[model samples]
Target: MGSAAPAFYGRRVPLFFNPLEAAAHRLSIAPPMFDYFNTLGLHALVAAARLRVFDALRERPSTADGLATTLTIDPRTAEVLLRVLAGLGYLRVKGGRYRLTRTSRTWFTTDSPTSLVAGLEFWERTACVIWPRLAEAVRDGSPVTPFYELLESDAALSRSFQAWTAALARRQAPATARIIPVPRDGGHVLDVGGSHGLFSVELLHRHPGLRATVLDLPQALEAAADHPRLTLRAGSFLDDDLGEGYDVALLFNIVHGLDDQEVAKLFARVAAALNPGGAIVIGDQFRDSLMPGRASRTLLDLLDLNYRVATGGRVRDFREVARMLRAAGFDRPRHRRPLRSVVTELAVAVVKSPSRP
Candidate 1:
């Protein structure tokens, strides 16, 4: 059967087909479905390991009954879930005993430095809940999603979120540090929303003279406490005072989460903080509709809806960001396309002189 569905009652139905045809039809729509599947997949994989199924298997391949007793699950249900996971390649079965596959060994190993277990935990614990409200976010024009509001009210949830955010920065910090220029001649850096102080750590490692002030919620300081080169301050970017006279300030992935008015205020603050001849870098997925041969950027416009709903923030297009920079009293914006995703554009705005407030 062809992948395309036939029409019925003003809507196409894939279930009308035979079992093989229905499976093929489902595979045809798997691209969009994969987004939904990714939520459960990563987390489930983590949860299984957390429940000690892998460790149980590590000692020796075990029958489902053995795994169930060790993992505290019912034998019959554990058998079903195990077989499904084995089919999905997380495990393998031989002689009626289940074993962890190589795919599980690489990332699922607790000792692996590059393990994605934290990433999976963040998804299972949060993103899965937030994504269901995408349509509501699109309709409401509000950046704060129900998930964020929930976080504000729930202290435990908020802490989990902060931890996940910090983990993400820590994991990606080395890569970011490699790309960002660290001045050897001695200059301070302002790490805007500097979660975990990864940026500061990486920068200071590269340049001995660089000191950084990480401006974020005080709760975020938990991740930054050990970094000698970083000083953590607690305050909102809009309401808090950003200290004056820095040579280079970084607004990495910060602008995308705020509205135009909020971004304008932030720019004005950043401009005030910079010394004359200083530079401000706005690193984010700056939307570029014209980029040739790249569909990922275009697709990100859809993914950004999650940010909009959950945090009261909106991702910016390149043009929108440039205009905001100019309005905040900066010279023309300079942009660098560092990655294929629209999220990775680094827009640097130069502060030539202090503007009269």
Candidate 2:
């Protein structure tokens, strides 16, 4: 018999095996690389831009020394920052002079409509700090809670939290508009933890028959009084009693930021508020076996970790959520894929029989 090669080194015979399977296995197990590279470049860009490096460059393409003179920075430090930007494909260097690359021209211009500078500034000031506590959060349970604890004395931090929450709602409003379902008739829709009523506004716009009630912190509500079509209520889910007789209740990106007990209480509350045959729609990231391309639970797991540390909450699996729904009086839960990123799962549960209630 011929000598056998080690398993680590594929033999000539093994070469005939399927390459696709091998590639798939490798990809499945490999860690995400260059993860910090983009963030590093962003930080550098923000720092350099704040120092007026981009403004100086726009004025004229000059050597590092001349650029430093204009910006009032050390020539070596300016050159280093310029090189970083070049490596990130934002700038180009030739013969010791620099100019904005084509990629930067469109975005870096002062009056460009697509400027992401403000968003970048927001991330640098807030998100960056919160991300580091993700591990600690995962072990504890709430991403923002722990962060708030750390910055409890800082009033600005508290304001930033609310601001970012609204900003995030606005950013995803378009995407959420596409996925969320609107009732055929003027059915009542309850928005749990929805900020600024953006999703409600979209729901109303998309489905003329749909009326919505947005439940959020008192300060988060944009409108006063529950209108004939649209209503905004101010109260915490834990303390306030949920109004009854909702045809559809929406929990968007809310449950994941809560622990099991809190989630149980929320589902129970939602069940109590739901009318007969009414459905509860949950929108969030979940671990799904069927939806491969649509799932990003792993990337979101980091966010889960942050939530854990910050709020004492966690993202639950589909089965876990289903069980919670069932315990809260839901019948068989149904899943839907109306959009990407936001998984829409519905559970129709009985609150109480007419004989009992």
Error of 2 at 9 (Å): 28
Considering every candidate listed, which one attains the maximal lDDT? 1
Whole-model lDDT per candidate: 0.68, 0.63
- Stretches > 4 Å off in candidate 2: 1-39, 45-155, 158-175, 222-229, 289-298, 340-357
Candidate with the greatest TM-score versus the true structure = 1
Q: Model 2 over residues 171-265: C-alpha lDDT tens digits?
A: 55566667554557778888888755766776777787888888876544543234457877777776688888788788877887777888888
Give the worst 10-residue stretch by lDDT in candidate 1: 6-15
Reference-based lDDT, residue 32, model 2: 30
Clashing pairs in 1: 143-312, 144-312, 145-309, 257-313, 284-343, 285-342, 285-343
